[model samples]
Target chain A: MLGAMEVVSPTAPPRGARGLHRFANPGRFLRLAGRALPWVSAIGLVLVALGLVWGLFFAPADWQQGDAVRIMYVHVPAAWLASAGYMALACASAVALVWRHPLADLAAVEIAPVGAGFTAICLVTGSLWGKPMWGAFWVWDARLTSVLVLFFLYLGHIALTRAFDSPERGYRAGAILALVGVVNLPIIKFSVDWWNTLHQPASITLTGAPTMYVGMLWPLLFTALGASFIFAALVLARLSAAVMERRIRALLAARAEGT
Target chain B: MTHLAYIVPAYVSALVIPAWLAGEAWLRLRRARARLLALEGGRRR
Candidate 1:
Protein backbone atom coordinates (compact mmCIF):
# COMPACT_ATOMS: atom_id res chain seq x y z
CA MET A 1 0.00 0.00 0.00
CA LEU A 2 2.82 2.40 0.81
CA GLY A 3 4.55 1.43 -2.44
CA ALA A 4 2.32 3.62 -4.60
CA MET A 5 4.20 6.42 -6.40
CA GLU A 6 3.93 8.73 -9.38
CA VAL A 7 5.35 8.30 -12.90
CA VAL A 8 8.31 10.44 -11.86
CA SER A 9 10.35 8.88 -9.06
CA PRO A 10 10.07 10.42 -5.59
CA THR A 11 13.71 11.53 -5.67
CA ALA A 12 13.40 13.10 -9.12
CA PRO A 13 12.42 16.74 -9.43
CA PRO A 14 9.03 17.51 -10.88
CA ARG A 15 8.85 19.40 -14.17
CA GLY A 16 9.32 23.24 -14.05
CA ALA A 17 10.95 23.69 -10.61
CA ARG A 18 14.30 25.26 -11.48
CA GLY A 19 14.84 27.40 -8.37
CA LEU A 20 15.35 24.49 -5.94
CA HIS A 21 16.77 22.01 -8.41
CA ARG A 22 20.24 22.03 -6.83
CA PHE A 23 18.97 20.80 -3.45
CA ALA A 24 17.00 17.91 -4.97
CA ASN A 25 19.59 15.44 -3.77
CA PRO A 26 17.81 12.98 -1.42
CA GLY A 27 21.02 11.33 -0.19
CA ARG A 28 22.18 14.54 1.51
CA PHE A 29 18.85 15.02 3.28
CA LEU A 30 18.77 11.37 4.44
CA ARG A 31 22.34 11.64 5.74
CA LEU A 32 21.61 14.90 7.59
CA ALA A 33 18.40 13.59 9.11
CA GLY A 34 20.15 10.39 10.19
CA ARG A 35 22.82 12.36 12.03
CA ALA A 36 20.36 14.67 13.75
CA LEU A 37 17.58 12.25 14.77
CA PRO A 38 19.26 10.74 17.83
CA TRP A 39 20.09 14.06 19.46
CA VAL A 40 16.68 15.56 18.68
CA SER A 41 14.74 12.61 20.09
CA ALA A 42 16.78 12.41 23.30
CA ILE A 43 16.78 16.13 24.06
CA GLY A 44 13.13 16.64 23.17
CA LEU A 45 11.81 13.76 25.30
CA VAL A 46 13.92 14.69 28.32
CA LEU A 47 12.83 18.32 28.22
CA VAL A 48 9.18 17.32 27.93
CA ALA A 49 9.48 14.97 30.91
CA LEU A 50 11.16 17.63 33.01
CA GLY A 51 8.67 20.31 32.00
CA LEU A 52 5.66 18.13 32.80
CA VAL A 53 7.08 17.28 36.21
CA TRP A 54 7.89 20.88 37.03
CA GLY A 55 4.52 22.14 35.92
CA LEU A 56 2.69 19.39 37.77
CA PHE A 57 4.45 19.55 41.13
CA PHE A 58 6.92 22.40 41.51
CA ALA A 59 5.29 25.28 39.68
CA PRO A 60 3.08 27.43 41.89
CA ALA A 61 -0.63 26.98 41.33
CA ASP A 62 -2.76 29.90 40.23
CA TRP A 63 -4.03 32.14 43.03
CA GLN A 64 -7.50 31.78 41.60
CA GLN A 65 -7.81 28.58 39.54
CA GLY A 66 -5.42 26.63 41.82
CA ASP A 67 -4.28 23.14 40.74
CA ALA A 68 -6.70 23.07 37.84
CA VAL A 69 -4.51 25.67 36.22
CA ARG A 70 -1.87 22.95 35.81
CA ILE A 71 -3.78 21.84 32.73
CA MET A 72 -2.59 25.04 31.01
CA TYR A 73 0.93 23.60 30.91
CA VAL A 74 -0.35 21.07 28.39
CA HIS A 75 -3.25 22.99 26.82
CA VAL A 76 -1.45 26.22 25.97
CA PRO A 77 1.48 24.45 24.34
CA ALA A 78 -0.87 22.32 22.30
CA ALA A 79 -2.79 25.41 21.23
CA TRP A 80 0.39 27.29 20.28
CA LEU A 81 1.84 24.34 18.38
CA ALA A 82 -1.50 23.67 16.74
CA SER A 83 -1.39 27.11 15.14
CA ALA A 84 2.36 27.20 14.53
CA GLY A 85 2.40 23.71 13.04
CA TYR A 86 -0.39 24.62 10.63
CA MET A 87 1.52 27.70 9.59
CA ALA A 88 4.46 25.42 8.90
CA LEU A 89 2.27 22.97 6.97
CA ALA A 90 0.91 25.82 4.89
CA CYS A 91 4.41 27.10 4.13
CA ALA A 92 5.55 23.62 3.16
CA SER A 93 2.52 23.37 0.92
CA ALA A 94 3.39 26.67 -0.74
CA VAL A 95 6.88 25.40 -1.44
CA ALA A 96 5.54 22.12 -2.76
CA LEU A 97 3.02 23.86 -5.01
CA VAL A 98 5.37 26.59 -6.23
CA TRP A 99 8.69 24.78 -6.47
CA ARG A 100 7.27 21.26 -6.67
CA HIS A 101 9.63 20.43 -3.83
CA PRO A 102 9.14 16.71 -3.16
CA LEU A 103 10.61 17.02 0.30
CA ALA A 104 8.20 19.85 1.01
CA ASP A 105 5.35 17.63 -0.08
CA LEU A 106 6.56 14.83 2.15
CA ALA A 107 6.95 17.36 4.94
CA ALA A 108 3.38 18.61 4.50
CA VAL A 109 2.15 15.02 4.59
CA GLU A 110 4.16 14.26 7.72
CA ILE A 111 3.22 17.44 9.58
CA ALA A 112 -0.54 17.00 9.20
CA PRO A 113 -1.01 13.91 11.37
CA VAL A 114 1.24 15.25 14.11
CA GLY A 115 -0.36 18.67 13.82
CA ALA A 116 -3.78 17.10 14.01
CA GLY A 117 -2.82 15.23 17.17
CA PHE A 118 -1.65 18.42 18.86
CA THR A 119 -4.79 20.24 17.83
CA ALA A 120 -6.82 17.41 19.31
CA ILE A 121 -4.93 17.82 22.56
CA CYS A 122 -5.69 21.52 22.49
CA LEU A 123 -9.40 21.01 21.99
CA VAL A 124 -9.70 18.17 24.49
CA THR A 125 -7.73 19.90 27.20
CA GLY A 126 -9.57 23.15 26.59
CA SER A 127 -12.86 21.36 27.00
CA LEU A 128 -11.66 19.69 30.18
CA TRP A 129 -10.47 23.00 31.56
CA GLY A 130 -13.75 24.62 30.61
CA LYS A 131 -15.80 22.17 32.64
CA PRO A 132 -14.51 23.63 35.92
CA MET A 133 -14.11 27.22 34.74
CA TRP A 134 -17.04 27.79 32.39
CA GLY A 135 -19.49 25.13 33.58
CA ALA A 136 -19.61 23.72 30.05
CA PHE A 137 -17.57 21.13 28.15
CA TRP A 138 -18.26 22.55 24.70
CA VAL A 139 -19.19 25.96 23.34
CA TRP A 140 -19.66 27.61 19.97
CA ASP A 141 -17.55 30.63 20.81
CA ALA A 142 -15.46 32.19 18.02
CA ARG A 143 -12.12 30.87 19.29
CA LEU A 144 -13.41 27.36 19.76
CA THR A 145 -15.24 27.22 16.44
CA SER A 146 -12.26 28.57 14.52
CA VAL A 147 -9.98 25.98 16.12
CA LEU A 148 -12.50 23.29 15.23
CA VAL A 149 -12.31 24.43 11.62
CA LEU A 150 -8.51 24.22 11.79
CA PHE A 151 -8.80 20.66 13.04
CA PHE A 152 -11.00 19.70 10.10
CA LEU A 153 -8.55 21.37 7.76
CA TYR A 154 -5.80 19.17 9.13
CA LEU A 155 -7.96 16.08 8.70
CA GLY A 156 -8.81 17.12 5.15
CA HIS A 157 -5.14 17.52 4.30
CA ILE A 158 -4.40 14.05 5.64
CA ALA A 159 -7.23 12.40 3.75
CA LEU A 160 -6.52 14.25 0.50
CA THR A 161 -2.82 13.31 0.60
CA ARG A 162 -3.63 9.58 0.77
CA ALA A 163 -6.79 9.62 -1.33
CA PHE A 164 -5.21 8.97 -4.70
CA ASP A 165 -3.14 6.10 -6.05
CA SER A 166 -0.59 8.51 -7.52
CA PRO A 167 1.34 10.33 -4.82
CA GLU A 168 1.90 13.37 -7.04
CA ARG A 169 -1.82 13.90 -7.43
CA GLY A 170 -2.36 13.39 -3.73
CA TYR A 171 0.39 15.86 -2.87
CA ARG A 172 -0.87 18.46 -5.31
CA ALA A 173 -4.44 18.25 -4.05
CA GLY A 174 -3.33 18.32 -0.44
CA ALA A 175 -1.11 21.33 -1.14
CA ILE A 176 -4.02 23.27 -2.56
CA LEU A 177 -6.19 22.46 0.46
CA ALA A 178 -3.47 23.57 2.87
CA LEU A 179 -2.94 26.85 1.07
CA VAL A 180 -6.68 27.59 1.07
CA GLY A 181 -6.94 26.90 4.80
CA VAL A 182 -4.24 29.49 5.68
CA VAL A 183 -6.90 32.19 6.10
CA ASN A 184 -8.12 30.64 9.37
CA LEU A 185 -4.89 31.38 11.25
CA PRO A 186 -5.55 35.08 11.88
CA ILE A 187 -9.17 34.41 12.73
CA ILE A 188 -8.12 31.96 15.41
CA LYS A 189 -5.53 34.39 16.71
CA PHE A 190 -7.83 37.39 17.23
CA SER A 191 -11.09 35.58 17.89
CA VAL A 192 -11.30 36.70 21.50
CA ASP A 193 -11.04 40.39 20.65
CA TRP A 194 -13.01 40.19 17.39
CA TRP A 195 -16.13 39.36 19.35
CA ASN A 196 -17.24 39.02 22.97
CA THR A 197 -16.30 35.37 23.34
CA LEU A 198 -16.08 33.12 26.37
CA HIS A 199 -12.40 32.45 25.61
CA GLN A 200 -9.86 34.66 27.36
CA PRO A 201 -7.64 37.11 25.51
CA ALA A 202 -4.00 36.25 24.81
CA SER A 203 -1.77 36.43 27.90
CA ILE A 204 1.41 36.46 25.85
CA THR A 205 2.03 38.62 22.82
CA LEU A 206 5.02 39.52 20.66
CA THR A 207 4.94 43.23 21.54
CA GLY A 208 3.86 43.30 25.19
CA ALA A 209 4.91 41.63 28.42
CA PRO A 210 3.08 38.47 29.38
CA THR A 211 0.05 39.03 31.59
CA MET A 212 0.94 35.85 33.51
CA TYR A 213 3.32 35.63 36.45
CA VAL A 214 6.90 34.36 35.98
CA GLY A 215 6.14 31.36 38.15
CA MET A 216 3.28 30.33 35.86
CA LEU A 217 4.86 31.45 32.59
CA TRP A 218 8.20 29.67 32.83
CA PRO A 219 6.72 26.18 33.00
CA LEU A 220 4.53 26.91 29.98
CA LEU A 221 7.55 28.16 28.05
CA PHE A 222 9.60 25.12 28.96
CA THR A 223 6.83 22.75 27.94
CA ALA A 224 6.21 24.70 24.74
CA LEU A 225 9.90 24.50 23.80
CA GLY A 226 10.08 20.84 24.76
CA ALA A 227 6.93 19.90 22.82
CA SER A 228 8.01 21.90 19.77
CA PHE A 229 11.29 19.97 19.67
CA ILE A 230 9.44 16.67 20.00
CA PHE A 231 7.11 17.72 17.20
CA ALA A 232 10.08 18.47 14.95
CA ALA A 233 11.67 15.14 15.83
CA LEU A 234 8.47 13.24 14.96
CA VAL A 235 8.09 15.01 11.62
CA LEU A 236 11.75 14.41 10.72
CA ALA A 237 11.47 10.71 11.55
CA ARG A 238 8.34 10.38 9.43
CA LEU A 239 9.95 12.21 6.49
CA SER A 240 12.98 9.90 6.61
CA ALA A 241 10.76 6.84 6.67
CA ALA A 242 8.69 8.05 3.71
CA VAL A 243 11.80 8.70 1.64
CA MET A 244 13.24 5.28 2.49
CA GLU A 245 9.96 3.58 1.68
CA ARG A 246 9.96 5.25 -1.74
CA ARG A 247 13.47 3.97 -2.45
CA ILE A 248 12.47 0.47 -1.39
CA ARG A 249 9.49 0.68 -3.73
CA ALA A 250 11.72 1.81 -6.61
CA LEU A 251 14.19 -0.98 -5.88
CA LEU A 252 11.44 -3.58 -5.88
CA ALA A 253 10.16 -2.19 -9.17
CA ALA A 254 13.58 -2.51 -10.78
CA ARG A 255 13.94 -6.13 -9.58
CA ALA A 256 10.48 -6.97 -10.88
CA GLU A 257 11.40 -5.56 -14.29
CA GLY A 258 14.69 -7.49 -14.26
CA THR A 259 12.92 -10.74 -13.34
CA MET B 1 -8.25 16.69 44.91
CA THR B 2 -9.53 19.87 43.33
CA HIS B 3 -10.67 18.92 39.88
CA LEU B 4 -8.47 15.82 39.75
CA ALA B 5 -11.17 14.26 37.61
CA TYR B 6 -10.54 16.87 34.91
CA ILE B 7 -6.81 17.34 35.56
CA VAL B 8 -5.93 13.64 35.48
CA PRO B 9 -7.61 13.00 32.14
CA ALA B 10 -6.20 16.14 30.58
CA TYR B 11 -2.66 15.17 31.62
CA VAL B 12 -3.18 11.58 30.53
CA SER B 13 -4.47 12.58 27.10
CA ALA B 14 -1.61 15.03 26.64
CA LEU B 15 0.92 12.27 27.39
CA VAL B 16 -0.86 9.35 25.70
CA ILE B 17 -1.77 10.96 22.37
CA PRO B 18 1.68 12.35 21.54
CA ALA B 19 3.41 9.26 22.90
CA TRP B 20 1.25 7.07 20.68
CA LEU B 21 2.00 9.20 17.63
CA ALA B 22 5.71 9.28 18.47
CA GLY B 23 5.77 5.52 18.93
CA GLU B 24 4.09 5.02 15.56
CA ALA B 25 6.58 7.36 13.89
CA TRP B 26 9.49 5.44 15.41
CA LEU B 27 8.07 2.09 14.37
CA ARG B 28 7.51 3.26 10.81
CA LEU B 29 11.08 4.53 10.53
CA ARG B 30 12.52 1.34 12.03
CA ARG B 31 10.52 -0.84 9.67
CA ALA B 32 11.45 1.18 6.63
CA ARG B 33 15.17 1.12 7.52
CA ALA B 34 15.18 -2.63 8.16
CA ARG B 35 13.32 -3.49 4.98
CA LEU B 36 15.55 -1.16 2.97
CA LEU B 37 18.63 -2.86 4.44
CA ALA B 38 17.32 -6.31 3.60
CA LEU B 39 16.44 -5.36 0.03
CA GLU B 40 19.82 -3.66 -0.63
CA GLY B 41 21.71 -6.62 0.93
CA GLY B 42 19.73 -9.08 -1.17
CA ARG B 43 20.55 -7.14 -4.34
CA ARG B 44 24.29 -7.28 -3.52
CA ARG B 45 24.15 -11.04 -2.91
Candidate 2:
Protein backbone atom coordinates (compact mmCIF):
# COMPACT_ATOMS: atom_id res chain seq x y z
CA MET A 1 0.00 0.00 0.00
CA LEU A 2 1.43 3.29 -1.09
CA GLY A 3 0.86 5.90 1.58
CA ALA A 4 -0.16 9.27 0.22
CA MET A 5 2.34 11.91 1.30
CA GLU A 6 1.34 15.56 1.20
CA VAL A 7 3.59 18.51 1.96
CA VAL A 8 2.05 21.81 3.03
CA SER A 9 4.03 25.00 3.24
CA PRO A 10 2.93 27.74 5.66
CA THR A 11 -0.39 29.25 4.54
CA ALA A 12 -0.88 33.00 4.73
CA PRO A 13 -2.86 34.49 7.60
CA PRO A 14 -6.64 34.34 6.84
CA ARG A 15 -8.27 36.84 4.47
CA GLY A 16 -9.07 39.28 7.27
CA ALA A 17 -6.10 38.22 9.40
CA ARG A 18 -3.17 40.44 8.28
CA GLY A 19 -5.99 42.88 8.23
CA LEU A 20 -7.36 41.06 11.28
CA HIS A 21 -5.59 43.89 12.93
CA ARG A 22 -6.90 45.86 9.98
CA PHE A 23 -10.50 45.26 11.04
CA ALA A 24 -9.33 46.75 14.28
CA ASN A 25 -7.58 49.21 12.01
CA PRO A 26 -9.38 52.52 11.56
CA GLY A 27 -9.85 52.25 7.80
CA ARG A 28 -11.67 48.95 8.04
CA PHE A 29 -13.50 50.06 11.17
CA LEU A 30 -14.86 53.02 9.17
CA ARG A 31 -15.88 50.79 6.26
CA LEU A 32 -17.82 48.55 8.61
CA ALA A 33 -19.26 51.53 10.49
CA GLY A 34 -20.35 53.14 7.24
CA ARG A 35 -22.61 50.16 6.71
CA ALA A 36 -23.81 50.17 10.32
CA LEU A 37 -24.47 53.93 10.70
CA PRO A 38 -27.72 54.00 8.74
CA TRP A 39 -29.21 51.11 10.66
CA VAL A 40 -28.18 52.65 13.96
CA SER A 41 -29.61 55.98 12.94
CA ALA A 42 -32.93 54.41 11.94
CA ILE A 43 -33.25 52.27 15.04
CA GLY A 44 -32.25 55.16 17.27
CA LEU A 45 -35.09 57.23 15.89
CA VAL A 46 -37.61 54.44 16.47
CA LEU A 47 -36.40 53.74 19.99
CA VAL A 48 -36.52 57.39 20.93
CA ALA A 49 -40.05 57.64 19.58
CA LEU A 50 -41.28 54.52 21.34
CA GLY A 51 -39.62 55.58 24.56
CA LEU A 52 -41.11 59.08 24.44
CA VAL A 53 -44.60 57.94 23.46
CA TRP A 54 -44.68 55.21 26.07
CA GLY A 55 -43.19 57.52 28.66
CA LEU A 56 -45.38 60.51 28.02
CA PHE A 57 -48.81 59.04 27.28
CA PHE A 58 -49.12 55.30 27.73
CA ALA A 59 -47.14 54.95 30.93
CA PRO A 60 -49.19 55.66 34.01
CA ALA A 61 -48.26 58.66 36.08
CA ASP A 62 -46.97 57.97 39.56
CA TRP A 63 -49.52 58.37 42.38
CA GLN A 64 -47.02 60.40 44.36
CA GLN A 65 -45.05 62.07 41.59
CA GLY A 66 -47.81 62.31 38.99
CA ASP A 67 -46.40 63.21 35.59
CA ALA A 68 -43.43 64.89 37.24
CA VAL A 69 -41.96 61.43 37.63
CA ARG A 70 -41.87 60.78 33.91
CA ILE A 71 -38.59 62.62 33.88
CA MET A 72 -36.98 59.63 35.52
CA TYR A 73 -37.20 57.85 32.20
CA VAL A 74 -34.43 60.04 30.90
CA HIS A 75 -32.77 61.30 34.07
CA VAL A 76 -32.04 58.00 35.75
CA PRO A 77 -30.64 56.36 32.65
CA ALA A 78 -28.43 59.29 31.72
CA ALA A 79 -27.03 59.36 35.23
CA TRP A 80 -26.60 55.58 35.30
CA LEU A 81 -24.71 55.50 31.99
CA ALA A 82 -22.65 58.53 32.89
CA SER A 83 -20.95 56.59 35.68
CA ALA A 84 -21.07 53.30 33.80
CA GLY A 85 -19.36 54.86 30.80
CA TYR A 86 -16.43 56.21 32.83
CA MET A 87 -15.75 52.73 34.15
CA ALA A 88 -15.89 51.40 30.61
CA LEU A 89 -13.42 54.00 29.36
CA ALA A 90 -11.12 53.27 32.27
CA CYS A 91 -11.23 49.59 31.38
CA ALA A 92 -10.42 50.38 27.77
CA SER A 93 -7.53 52.56 28.87
CA ALA A 94 -6.23 49.69 30.99
CA VAL A 95 -6.43 47.29 28.06
CA ALA A 96 -4.67 49.78 25.84
CA LEU A 97 -1.90 50.24 28.33
CA VAL A 98 -1.42 46.56 29.07
CA TRP A 99 -1.75 44.87 25.68
CA ARG A 100 -1.27 47.96 23.54
CA HIS A 101 -4.21 46.82 21.41
CA PRO A 102 -3.69 48.77 18.22
CA LEU A 103 -6.76 50.93 18.43
CA ALA A 104 -7.50 50.61 22.12
CA ASP A 105 -5.95 53.91 23.15
CA LEU A 106 -7.58 55.71 20.29
CA ALA A 107 -10.86 54.19 21.40
CA ALA A 108 -10.28 55.55 24.86
CA VAL A 109 -9.33 58.94 23.49
CA GLU A 110 -12.34 59.35 21.20
CA ILE A 111 -14.76 58.17 23.87
CA ALA A 112 -13.83 60.42 26.79
CA PRO A 113 -15.37 63.49 25.20
CA VAL A 114 -18.63 61.67 24.55
CA GLY A 115 -18.62 60.22 28.03
CA ALA A 116 -17.89 63.67 29.42
CA GLY A 117 -20.80 65.07 27.47
CA PHE A 118 -23.13 62.42 28.90
CA THR A 119 -21.86 63.05 32.41
CA ALA A 120 -22.51 66.76 31.99
CA ILE A 121 -26.01 66.03 30.76
CA CYS A 122 -26.54 63.71 33.70
CA LEU A 123 -25.41 66.32 36.19
CA VAL A 124 -27.41 69.22 34.79
CA THR A 125 -30.58 67.21 34.33
CA GLY A 126 -30.19 65.67 37.75
CA SER A 127 -29.94 69.18 39.16
CA LEU A 128 -33.03 70.29 37.30
CA TRP A 129 -34.98 67.29 38.49
CA GLY A 130 -33.67 67.71 41.99
CA LYS A 131 -34.73 71.36 42.23
CA PRO A 132 -38.43 70.59 41.95
CA MET A 133 -38.31 67.75 44.46
CA TRP A 134 -35.57 68.93 46.80
CA GLY A 135 -36.25 72.68 46.58
CA ALA A 136 -32.74 73.58 45.49
CA PHE A 137 -30.92 73.64 42.20
CA TRP A 138 -27.71 72.25 43.74
CA VAL A 139 -26.56 70.65 46.94
CA TRP A 140 -23.36 69.43 48.58
CA ASP A 141 -25.06 66.10 49.17
CA ALA A 142 -22.71 63.13 49.11
CA ARG A 143 -23.95 61.41 45.95
CA LEU A 144 -24.13 64.69 44.09
CA THR A 145 -20.70 65.68 45.31
CA SER A 146 -19.23 62.35 44.35
CA VAL A 147 -20.78 62.53 40.90
CA LEU A 148 -19.32 66.00 40.51
CA VAL A 149 -15.93 64.51 41.31
CA LEU A 150 -16.57 61.86 38.69
CA PHE A 151 -17.23 64.62 36.20
CA PHE A 152 -13.97 66.32 37.14
CA LEU A 153 -12.19 63.01 36.74
CA TYR A 154 -13.57 62.79 33.23
CA LEU A 155 -12.40 66.29 32.41
CA GLY A 156 -9.02 65.38 33.86
CA HIS A 157 -8.86 62.27 31.72
CA ILE A 158 -9.55 64.34 28.64
CA ALA A 159 -6.98 66.96 29.49
CA LEU A 160 -4.27 64.54 30.61
CA THR A 161 -4.73 62.24 27.65
CA ARG A 162 -4.16 65.06 25.23
CA ALA A 163 -1.44 66.90 27.16
CA PHE A 164 1.66 65.38 25.67
CA ASP A 165 2.84 66.05 22.13
CA SER A 166 3.68 62.40 21.68
CA PRO A 167 0.41 60.58 21.48
CA GLU A 168 1.79 57.42 23.08
CA ARG A 169 3.00 59.27 26.14
CA GLY A 170 -0.30 61.02 26.48
CA TYR A 171 -2.23 57.75 26.25
CA ARG A 172 -0.07 55.87 28.78
CA ALA A 173 -0.29 58.61 31.37
CA GLY A 174 -4.00 59.01 30.83
CA ALA A 175 -4.52 55.27 31.23
CA ILE A 176 -2.81 55.36 34.59
CA LEU A 177 -4.90 58.32 35.69
CA ALA A 178 -8.10 56.64 34.52
CA LEU A 179 -7.39 53.44 36.45
CA VAL A 180 -6.71 55.45 39.57
CA GLY A 181 -10.04 57.19 39.11
CA VAL A 182 -12.08 53.94 38.99
CA VAL A 183 -12.23 53.98 42.79
CA ASN A 184 -14.51 57.02 42.63
CA LEU A 185 -17.25 55.08 40.82
CA PRO A 186 -17.95 52.78 43.76
CA ILE A 187 -17.72 55.68 46.14
CA ILE A 188 -20.36 57.50 44.13
CA LYS A 189 -22.74 54.55 44.41
CA PHE A 190 -22.32 54.20 48.16
CA SER A 191 -22.33 57.89 48.89
CA VAL A 192 -26.06 58.01 49.35
CA ASP A 193 -25.99 55.13 51.81
CA TRP A 194 -22.88 56.31 53.59
CA TRP A 195 -24.17 59.78 54.21
CA ASN A 196 -27.48 61.44 54.97
CA THR A 197 -28.01 63.57 51.93
CA LEU A 198 -30.62 65.52 50.00
CA HIS A 199 -30.11 63.39 46.90
CA GLN A 200 -32.55 60.49 46.67
CA PRO A 201 -31.18 57.04 47.33
CA ALA A 202 -31.36 54.18 44.90
CA SER A 203 -34.92 53.29 43.89
CA ILE A 204 -33.87 50.14 42.08
CA THR A 205 -31.35 47.54 43.18
CA LEU A 206 -30.59 43.83 43.15
CA THR A 207 -31.50 42.78 46.70
CA GLY A 208 -34.91 44.47 46.91
CA ALA A 209 -37.99 45.29 44.88
CA PRO A 210 -38.00 48.42 42.79
CA THR A 211 -40.07 51.38 43.93
CA MET A 212 -41.11 52.20 40.37
CA TYR A 213 -44.04 50.40 38.76
CA VAL A 214 -43.69 48.47 35.52
CA GLY A 215 -45.30 51.25 33.53
CA MET A 216 -42.65 53.71 34.62
CA LEU A 217 -39.87 51.16 34.62
CA TRP A 218 -40.48 50.22 31.01
CA PRO A 219 -39.87 53.74 29.68
CA LEU A 220 -36.74 54.02 31.78
CA LEU A 221 -35.57 50.71 30.35
CA PHE A 222 -36.20 51.81 26.78
CA THR A 223 -34.36 55.06 27.35
CA ALA A 224 -31.42 53.22 28.84
CA LEU A 225 -31.26 50.95 25.81
CA GLY A 226 -31.56 53.93 23.51
CA ALA A 227 -28.74 55.68 25.38
CA SER A 228 -26.52 52.61 25.02
CA PHE A 229 -27.12 52.43 21.27
CA ILE A 230 -26.40 56.12 20.96
CA PHE A 231 -23.11 55.63 22.77
CA ALA A 232 -22.12 52.72 20.54
CA ALA A 233 -22.96 54.60 17.38
CA LEU A 234 -21.13 57.71 18.47
CA VAL A 235 -18.06 55.85 19.68
CA LEU A 236 -17.83 53.89 16.44
CA ALA A 237 -18.10 57.00 14.33
CA ARG A 238 -15.53 58.98 16.33
CA LEU A 239 -13.05 56.12 16.56
CA SER A 240 -13.25 55.53 12.83
CA ALA A 241 -12.51 59.19 12.20
CA ALA A 242 -9.62 59.30 14.66
CA VAL A 243 -8.02 56.32 12.97
CA MET A 244 -8.42 57.92 9.55
CA GLU A 245 -6.87 61.17 10.72
CA ARG A 246 -3.87 59.35 12.11
CA ARG A 247 -3.41 57.56 8.80
CA ILE A 248 -3.57 60.85 6.92
CA ARG A 249 -1.03 62.43 9.23
CA ALA A 250 1.31 59.45 8.82
CA LEU A 251 1.04 59.64 5.06
CA LEU A 252 1.85 63.33 5.07
CA ALA A 253 4.81 62.76 7.37
CA ALA A 254 6.12 60.05 5.10
CA ARG A 255 5.70 62.23 2.05
CA ALA A 256 7.52 65.08 3.73
CA GLU A 257 10.41 62.84 4.70
CA GLY A 258 10.65 61.52 1.18
CA THR A 259 10.71 65.01 -0.31
CA MET B 1 -45.49 68.95 43.44
CA THR B 2 -46.82 71.53 41.00
CA HIS B 3 -46.86 69.33 37.92
CA LEU B 4 -46.80 71.66 34.95
CA ALA B 5 -43.43 73.34 35.42
CA TYR B 6 -41.70 70.12 36.36
CA ILE B 7 -43.33 68.17 33.55
CA VAL B 8 -42.52 70.71 30.88
CA PRO B 9 -38.89 71.10 31.89
CA ALA B 10 -38.47 67.36 32.20
CA TYR B 11 -39.78 66.69 28.73
CA VAL B 12 -37.89 69.60 27.27
CA SER B 13 -34.55 68.59 28.75
CA ALA B 14 -35.05 64.99 27.76
CA LEU B 15 -35.85 65.88 24.18
CA VAL B 16 -33.62 68.88 23.68
CA ILE B 17 -30.37 67.71 25.23
CA PRO B 18 -30.20 64.38 23.47
CA ALA B 19 -31.24 66.03 20.23
CA TRP B 20 -28.46 68.52 20.66
CA LEU B 21 -25.97 65.77 21.39
CA ALA B 22 -27.09 63.71 18.42
CA GLY B 23 -26.75 66.73 16.19
CA GLU B 24 -23.28 67.54 17.51
CA ALA B 25 -22.00 64.00 17.10
CA TRP B 26 -23.45 63.81 13.61
CA LEU B 27 -21.80 67.06 12.59
CA ARG B 28 -18.42 65.92 13.87
CA LEU B 29 -18.75 62.62 12.04
CA ARG B 30 -19.77 64.36 8.84
CA ARG B 31 -16.91 66.82 8.94
CA ALA B 32 -14.36 64.13 9.64
CA ARG B 33 -15.69 61.92 6.86
CA ALA B 34 -15.65 64.79 4.40
CA ARG B 35 -12.06 65.68 5.16
CA LEU B 36 -11.01 62.08 4.83
CA LEU B 37 -12.77 61.84 1.48
CA ALA B 38 -11.08 64.97 0.24
CA LEU B 39 -7.72 63.56 1.24
CA GLU B 40 -8.50 60.34 -0.59
CA GLY B 41 -9.42 62.22 -3.72
CA GLY B 42 -6.25 64.28 -3.60
CA ARG B 43 -4.16 61.15 -3.21
CA ARG B 44 -5.81 59.50 -6.19
CA ARG B 45 -5.03 62.47 -8.43
Write down the lDDT of every candidate, Cα atoms only. 0.87, 0.74
Tens digits of lDDT, candidate 2, A3-82: 11111112232364552254554545665676776677567667767887888788887776667777777778778878
Q: RMSD in angstroms, all models?
A: 4.6, 8.8
Docking model 1 quality class: medium
Poorest 10 consecutive residues by lDDT, candidate 1 chain A: A1-10
Please, what is the TM-score per model? 0.92, 0.86
| Candidate that would win on DockQ | 1
> Which of the numbered candidates is closest to the native, going by highest TM-score?
1
Colliding pairs, model 2: A17-A20, A19-A22
Judge candidate 1 at residue B43 and give its lDDT.
Answer: 73
Give model 2's share of reference contacts: 0.35
Off by over 4 Å in 2: A1-23
Question: Chain A only: TM-score of every candidate?
Answer: 0.91, 0.88
lDDT of 1 by residue, A140-187 (tens): 999999999999999999999999999999999999999999999999
